[model samples]
Target: MSRNTESPVDVDEALTHIDSRGAKIRKEQLERTLSQLQADSELTADQRLAVERLSERLVDRLLAVPRASLQDAAQNADEETIETAMSLFE
Candidate 1:
């Protein structure tokens, strides 16, 4: 019997692995990344403040809608909403 030895994976670099983990897992990854960025020692005071503001905005947006409704909107975005989004890019 032959044993196969493979190198350990860097989970963050594996796109397919990340995608397979679904929304909750991806949310966790986003939080971990944000925390890591916030803790970086080299950021200037202004840069840190900007990151803090962005983080607050992210929290606000996430809490603006209930999870079920957000999921529903994502799965069934109405034509009017789609058109409005398209117009923004035009």
Candidate 2:
């Protein structure tokens, strides 16, 4: 009979390591993007701060609500609201 090469614990550990690495990479990317946005000379400091705060608020809302609730809210949003939100991201 064929035999397993690795134990289930080993597989779980490898997956945990992969997840940690992915999270670290995402955190680094977010830091770089935030730095770039804050360093933009075209925007006043206050404007840059406002943009950052708006992003943080959106993140807070996401964390506060269930995924389905957020999805439903997005789906139900009117065209003007959707366009405004999309434009802000762009």
Candidate 3:
């Protein structure tokens, strides 16, 4: 029998949520996390991309939950999400 290690076919994407009470705090935390991650030479491009995607996707949800920094939130995040949001938005 063959084994399928991936998520079920119905699961189109996986999401991670971050929480923060203040917009300024959330922005600072997200920026710090992104800058740190972007600077890391040890992480692969795909790994960074996935994290960025998850962070961008969860901005709203992140602001909803009880106060939590994306620094902590991103750490708790699953380390991967859906697509790319790294390209400069023109």
Candidate 4:
């Protein structure tokens, strides 16, 4: 069976594409969460500044996660979220 270059049957390519899609989705979700935090009415100036800084840090950290295992990346992201939530009280 001859392989078609126009139609990829490469397993690695398919996995790479899937992982790329998942990372895109996670990035969008993070953006939405940050937007919600920024739009909240009750936050004081310092709280808002803290959230904005944290949001930027999250974006940086998220971009650094390996693309091959997005589920694990997301789990680690959830840990960051938990840490951020806790930081609000401290």
Give the winner by TM-score.
4
Pick the winner on lDDT between candidates 3 and 4: 4
Off by over 4 Å in 2: 1-9, 41-90
Model 3 clash count equals 1
- Please give the lDDT score at residue 83 for candidate 4: 33
Cα lDDT of model 4 by residue, 1-90, tens digit: 233355423333333555465556656776686678768755677875676577557655654443334444344543333333323323
Which residue pairs clash within candidate 2?
A: none
lDDT for 54 (candidate 2):
65
Show the lowest summed lDDT stretch of 10 residues, model 1: 9-18
The local distance difference test score of model 3 is 0.42
Query: What ranking of all candidate models by TM-score puts the best one first?
Result: 4, 2, 1, 3
Task: TM-score for candidate 3, please give it.
Answer: 0.30
- What is residue 22's positional error in candidate 3, in angstroms? 8.2
Model 2 TM-score on a 0 to 1 scale:
0.36
| Model 3: ten consecutive residues of lowest lDDT | 81-90
Per residue, candidate 1 scores C-alpha lDDT tens digits across 1-90 of: 123264432322232232333344445755686678768756677875676566556654653343333334445633333333333323
Best by lDDT: 4
> lDDT per residue, candidate 3, 21-63, as tens digits?
2344546777788788768756787886777676656765644
- For each candidate in turn, the TM-score is 0.31, 0.36, 0.30, 0.37
